[model samples]
Every structure is written in C-alpha cells, then in structure tokens.
Target: MTAGPDPVAPGRTTTSSASTGELFGAVTRDLSTLIRQEIELAKAEATQSARNAGRGVGMFGGAGVAVHLALIFVSLALWWALGDPVGLGWSGVIVAVLWAIVAAVLALRGRTELRRVQGLPRTADTVKKIPHALQGHEEENS
Candidate 1:
C-alpha cells in the first residue's frame, strides 16, 4: 500500500516533524493573535454604534425644536382667528386657559402613571433569593 501522507500530522507543513513544545508555541501565538483581532473588531463596532446613536439623538433634538416652533405659530394663528370674533385680549386669555387645562391634565396623568410603577419588584425578589440559592437551598414551589 502506497501511503499518501501522515493523517495525524495534517497541520504540519514541514517534511521534518517539529517538537511538541514548538507546536504548542505556534498554537498559543495563533490563539493570542485571534483574540487580539476579535477585541479590536469589537472596539471598532462599538465606536461605530456610538457614533450612529449620537447622530440619531441630534436628529431627534432638531425634530423637537421644529415641533416647538410649529406649535408656537399654530397658537399665534388660532389667537388671530379668535381675535376677529372676540377682542385680541380675550382671545389671548382663552388660548392661555386652554393650554393651562391641557398642562394640568397631562400632569395628573403622568403622576398616576408614576404611582403605578412597581420599581423592579421582580428584580428585587430575585436579588433577595440569591443568597439562599447560592447556599444550595432549593426553593419549594408554592
């Protein structure tokens, strides 16, 4: 039978075999380089993601400013329209009252939502049980 090559030494390129120490050194160097490359890749991806997030935040800020300006113009237009029927002074007061009522309603609703928040109840429960769990005390199912 004509032997083609050594199946056990598939990674060995040299015709002369290397020592186990040399093989181990080569593997260690390759693994170290692979880990370094992976870390560098992660850093680059994180930087890119951070930059994208910054741009998105800037865009949102711009949109918010534009919306505020639009609301101001709309309020002014409504005030002028109402001024033709009522006096300009009464129209302004009417608009102010409407905005005040809107603010009050929003504030009350926001307070209610804040009150309803459970403040991570599940996380607190899990944290309290961590000491017991680590001590190998299995919790009985109720």
Candidate 2:
C-alpha cells in the first residue's frame, strides 16, 4: 500500500518534496564521505603497522647477527677443547659433522613450526561474524 501524491503538489513536484529529496541526497553523500574516511583511516593504520613490523624485523636481524658472532666464539672454544683428545683436523671435522646434524634438526623443526602458523585466523573468524552480530542473529539454537 502507498499514499497518493499530495494534493497541494498535484504533479508531485513541490518545494517540500524537493527538500525531502535533497535531505536524502545529503544523507547519502555524507554516508559516502564517512565510508571513504573510514577506509582511509584503516589504510593509514595498516601502513603504520607494516612500518612497525619492518622495523621490528630489522632489529631482530641485527640481534641474530650479533648472536651468530657469539656462537662462532663458542664453537671455536669447543673445537679447542676437543683438540686435546683428537688432532686439529679431526677436531674440526667432528665439529663440522655435529653442526651439520644440528642444522638438519633445526631446519626440520622450523619447517614444522612455520607450517603450523595460521596468520590472523582468529581475527578473520571474528570479523566474519560481525554482520551476523549486527543483524541480531546471536547464537540461540546453537
């Protein structure tokens, strides 16, 4: 069911109708602006987060290099210790074989850990549920 055009507006063209449409148009334009602003805000936040992550990764790399230098000294000490039992060449070969085995084990474990990672899965699931939550379709029947 619908109401007929206002009698005062005969052809449905009147100042009041035009004003109402103008209001609707204004609201639509404002909504579009608001959505664009929100998108820009999100983009800015994401950019900041990426910059932070890059800095963090670089810092970690620096730390890793420092640790590697420390490990080199430690390995040299271990080779010197074994030098008493075996000759220099055999001691170096033994250390090399031990490092090879350790590298293989670490590589396998690191691969497994990387495979287990699911980036932002919980956030993704929560975002997916937002529309349903906004529509008042909360869990009831389960």
Candidate number of the best TM-score: 2
* Cα lDDT computed for each candidate against the true fold: 0.67, 0.67
Which segments of candidate 2 are over 4 A away from where they belong? Answer: 1-20, 86-90, 93-142
Model 1 agreement with the true structure over 88-135: per-residue lDDT tens digits: 999999999988997799678656744653334444454455456545
Q: How accurate is candidate 2 locally (lDDT)?
A: 0.67
| Ten contiguous residues minimizing lDDT sum, candidate 1 | 117-126
Give every collision pair in model 1.
none
What is the lDDT, from 0 to 100, of the residue 11 in candidate 2? 52
Error of 1 at 4 (Å): 21
Error of 1 at 78 (Å): 2.5
- What are the clashing pairs of model 2? none
TM-score, prediction 2 = 0.50
